[model samples]
Target: MATVVPEESTASTEVKAHEVRPPRKPSASQIAAARSLPNNNEAVWPAFTTKLPSSLYIDEDRFDEEHRKLFMTLPLPLAPSALLAEPGSFVCRDGFGQSVILTRDKDGKVHALVNSCRHRGSRVTENDEPAKGRLMICPYHAWSYDLSGKLMAVPRREVFGELDKSELGMVKLPCVEKGGIIWVKMDHEANDDFSHVSDELVADFDALGVADMHMFALRKHEVEGNWKLILDTFLEGYHVIRLHVQTVGPLYEDTVVQVDRLGSHLRQTSARVGFTKDILAQNEESVDDLRRVVTYVYTLLPNVAFICSQDYCNMLVMQPKGVGKTIVHNFMLTNVNPQSEKLRQKWEKSLELTDGLAFPEDFSASAATYQGLTTGVVKELMIGGMEVAMEHYHEMIEEMVARA
Candidate 1:
């Protein structure tokens, strides 16, 4: 492990960390909602029906608009903070066709920068080269930039008239580390705000100890489907029995879910089919009990999903690749292993089972839906009453796109 960097006077770090509050336990009502889902069988629904136009998924112009107006403008979720554990650690990603680099500086602050060079617009960091806190030198013209995005060297002085290096740094985006994940607004302008995301919801993520957990795997898979098609799997339980019958079918119920909306985000907790009769018989269950007892699927609308099970959490970032393609980046996190071999194998087997069985089912279904959409059978998508979260997701996308 690298030495922890000291906190500095950086604006990005100061603004995010100051207002965060300690996490509070979930209320009794939340516990009841999770536990009683199978009993009541009623999912929370929106005020009106949501009908999604088919062109939103198939048309190239709408897809491009979604990328520019929604993805670039919204605070999009990226990798876990664990990936940047060491100072100078960084990750490269693609945002709406722009190559982005998220790096943690020596002062323990994370920054998002456009990866192109300031002089010739060439990439600063090569895929094979190390891109730590050291200077990022452009391959095209040898222009170098420091970790704080300041130009350091231009090679050969007085080449093209008088030039100031201070104004020629990499393009900086507004990025903040919160809820154990890093979020960046790629097209952030002055006075940009992410206050639409509720503080209580962020605190809910904190209660899960997302930042403190160890990240075991980071996998990226390309789905041959519209981004919204991929989100349906994360937002609804209705497809589990049909699409995931062989993999995770035995573990979850269909059409029975507890839905909660936190601003643009939504949480769907379904009663596990495997919840034994023994656990429910206990007289009193604690506030933190439902998480371990039920299956939770949270969709941070626009482009992210976090699914939590008994032993592990899988969070995903869906980036639009084209009108009918999406790149899904997922991070799997779990508790650190115990000293004993038996306990170690328990977590190991669970993660292995999840990796082997669950994800393939999801990706295959996404591809199937993508191919099916090209058939032109359905002109619009009908969001049923049971799939309320999916309805909420579609509505939110329309609202944002309409305003944008």
Candidate 2:
């Protein structure tokens, strides 16, 4: 149920029953950082002529380097924070072939731990679903750990001889909950922080009120395409008219969008036909008007894509598997009542539209492009100005990989 302010309230103070204050918009500097190049309505108009190397997308060596240089060193956005609402709640995640456990202990503090048990290195937790219990017991030996990753017990202490329980706790990873999502820097040896992720990104993250949202639905799908290619599909609105004609195209501008870059992250906001019409009619030229009336896609570098609408936040975490495949996790975060059939159905329609379009059209293009590139038929692909975000992304990848 949506919050409502009582009509009788005075101008000085009027609080809604369950209302929440909208999050701050991007700072002026942040906005300037994310601004994209100007583009014509054709959506395919020319801008910069930077050609991405064909091998960059399908090279096996490059894929392995990405795991080490990008995934391992970056502050990755995992699942949303809603999964940790309960004191003993936990969720497991698999990234870069490593298993991780994210838990909220009895103290209501969250911790990220490597899922492997200290004694035998067996996975102490499983992912793709939520789990809750006082102890996360290793199913192999009944060895257990507390939510904070503290060693609790070993079934037969005498059998262990002189082993120290304190020194054998689950390996804790450097993790923090930021922007309504859990972020972990995958370095097991270093005490790295998410400082490099930019305060601009985190400060602007809750713009859609994702911090208070609960998961409406979550799914994992493997697409037959390089992860970068899959992400490229979301960076531009050039294909909306021809590619998404039957679904979301008619509701949005035929061409034209603002693609901004905040550090390495890209925020692309497309003009909505219906909503844009209203703005033109009213002759309203507020600077923030475009943001208030369009769809926003924030591509968080290296992996996560945080898609935002006024009422919904769909976080897509693209986990690269091989040169030819990517594991995509779609997390639907919403404020709607989960138990209400009517509410859920309304929310589900949006997801259905995405699957219908992604599977048959948008994503298929990426997969096909990867196939073509692998065949050595193309030397490189040109990214135009309208798709400036794509160029920005490639450069960031190059810079990060080099820095590492």
> Which candidate number maximizes lDDT?
2
Q: Which stretches of candidate 1 lie above 4 Å from their native place?
A: 1-24, 27-51, 126-131, 158-161, 188-190, 274-288, 337-348
How far residue 325's Cα lies from its native spot in candidate 2, in Å, is 1.3
- After the best TM-score superposition of candidate 1, give how far the Cα of residue 395 lies from its true spot, in angstroms: 1.4
lDDT of candidate model 1 versus the reference: 0.68
- Cα displacement (angstroms), candidate 2, residue 295, comes to 1.9
Question: How does each model score on TM-score?
Answer: 0.83, 0.86
Give each prediction's root-mean-square deviation over alpha carbons.
8.8, 6.1
User: Best candidate, TM-score-wise?
Assistant: 2
lDDT of each: 0.68, 0.70
Q: What's the alpha carbon RMSD for model 1?
A: 8.8
lDDT of 1 by residue, 1-404 (tens): 00001112223332233223233465444555565554424434334456777787788888888887887777877677776767876666764778887888888898888888878788877552224657777878888887778899988968767998878988898888888888778773624587756675676677666776667677678888888887777777666666666655654554366678777777776655445435644422432345555666778768888887644577878888898888888777754424445444555566555555676677778788778778899788777666777767777788888897
Q: Which 10 consecutive positions of candidate 1 have the poorest summed lDDT?
A: 1-10
lDDT score for residue 175 of model 2: 85
